[model samples]
Target: MYYTDRGIEELEGRRGEEEVSFAWLSDRLRTFTDLNPEFETAVDRLATWLARLDDDEDE
Candidate 1:
């Protein structure tokens, strides 16, 4: 499997670390595995979102 069970569990843990809802995490996770063709887009979006939030908090 491209994403092993352990990988999925690890992904869940990473998702929790984000402090966001499971639904949002799940949606974003679609980018990590083989679930979506737009994986890169999802990753870029999350990166941008987190960077913006971090910047705002630092201001």
Candidate 2:
């Protein structure tokens, strides 16, 4: 397993049963960037990748 997989697993394990709105996620991401400026780019990339998942799926 990759190092990042631990973080992913923790996320899934902790919140897998929860359902959240885009606004909630956006706010969370913003807060994350505020606290972790260095990770902003990775978060941005993840958001962009997620935003385009549908487009990719249709291809």
Best by lDDT: 2
Evaluate model 1: give its lDDT.
0.67
| Candidates' C-alpha lDDT | 0.67, 0.93
Give the per-residue Cα lDDT of candidate 2 at 4.
94
The residue-level lDDT of candidate 1 at 29 comes to 67
Superposition error at 25 for model 2 (Å): 0.8
Write out the backbone clash pairs for model 2: none
Write the residue-wise lDDT of candidate 1 on 1-59 in tens digits: 56567877887887757667657765656646456655668666866686578687777
Can you tell me which runs of candidate 2 are displaced by over 4 Å? Answer: none
Task: Write candidate 2's Cα lDDT for 1-59 as tens digits.
Answer: 99999999999999999999988998899999999999989999988987888997688
State the RMSD for candidate 2. Answer: 1.2
- Please give the distance, in angstroms, between residue 38's alpha carbon in candidate 2 and its true position after superposition: 0.7
lDDT of 2: 0.93
Off by over 4 Å in 1: 1-37, 55-59
Candidate number with greatest TM-score? 2
